[model samples]
Target: MSIFRNLSSRAKEDELMDDFSMGGAELSEALVHLRRLNKIFAAPGPTRYGVEKLWRMMGSPASLSVLDVGAGSGDVNRKLLEWADSRGVELHIILVDLTEEACQEAAALFKDEPRIQVQRADVRDLPDASADIVTGSQFVHHFDGDELVDIVSHMLRASRYGVVINDIHRHQVSYTAVWLTTRLISRNRYIRHDGPLSVAKGFTARDWKELKRRLNHETMTFSWKPLFRYAVVIPHPLKPGGKESGIGYA
Candidate 1:
């Protein structure tokens, strides 16, 4: 085995890459650029744990509008809706993605549902869009320095309740997992390169802290999961443990 197999997860998968990032194909498995995207929509170890934890922690999801800025292949959106259905939480979703290709793909997943709408749009800057909950999974790791700051700022400004950003944790272990997982699980070239590259470029908890400082520490909560190799919840301030306090981290 390689030394990467022995490194911390944070270091391994943070820089993984997929086909989209590598320009290997026009389309492929959602997991190609789907590093963090999977857990948002589906359920598994850390990803499921994070979403479920936030659901119980928040206590009320009867009225929540969710915005997935970089809605890739509708993975996150589907998972959010599926969560609502299973938990009895009623949610409205606004799905925005950078490419229409993603829109076409996402549309298939949510085509029958009127509550979910996929739009070809950019989420780099969160507009005047107000949502009770703002969530992005595995998506934000695509940024570097100033771009990351700008994206987070835009997200913070738009959320009235809170935000949940499920993203890769920057580290060596994370890089390795991304590489191995892609190699073992996917055959798409785009997913392979972009997957590991994404891991290499991931962010750590410290980065989010810096974002909080720059954004006035507006009542947020942060959790980093080791297994999933990503940040689970970074929430906005509200009455702690209050059922209807309108505070949530998804």
Candidate 2:
């Protein structure tokens, strides 16, 4: 258990050798494992909750556009779409990832999903206010410091409604639990290494407070969710009063 708390601090680690770029049957299998992990742990639920918050804020718009940053395999986007559909809300999802392979995979997965589009692009380079809301799940932990600021800023800027980021919470219990669970159910080397690594790279509540202070954005809201996940939501800037209003915090 002590070994699971090996990281010096909440600082980001170097990017793991993610299997999404391996470009073969191996990548496909790795992605399958990744999707399974997200499903088993219900990683996308908090992101959907964030979207629900934004939807209510928008006066329950008939349609919404969401940009999912670092949308590996776009599983989160798929779940979000399903959630909106159940509520009779039309959803258009844009899946963005740095790896072309990831984009291609998402595109293929959602080809039947006429409302979904996939793009390979850097978050920093995305144009401003491109979607109704920008969402990411298990994504922000991959960046730190200036890069984290840039990503969050870009997500907020791209969302006409808001930004929702769902990521792990860095804690010894969180890390140890994921470490044990992944080892038991997953044989993918990437999952075994990156799962715990992701947890370790995740932020503490204190870290989120400091990050919000540094960003100096008045509209941003952060809360801890079930399953040791953090939900960070930044409401639309055009909203009256310019503060996160009415949305319930977890």
Top-lDDT structure, candidate number: 2
Q: On a 0 to 100 scale, what is the lDDT of residue 204 in model 2?
A: 85
State in Å the error of residue 161, model 2. Answer: 2.1
| Regions of candidate 2 where Cα sits further than 4 Å from its true position | 1-3, 17-24, 238-250
Error of 2 at 123 (Å): 1.3
Worst 10 residues of 2 by lDDT: 241-250
Q: What are the per-model C-alpha RMSD values against the true structure?
A: 5.5, 3.4
Per-model lDDT: 0.60, 0.79
Model 1 residue 65 distance off true place after TM-score fit, in angstroms: 1.4
Across residues 1-90, which tens digit of lDDT does each residue of candidate 1 receive? 242433232333333332235322445354334634354323233434444555565676565577777767656455556677877877
Each candidate's clash count: 49, 0
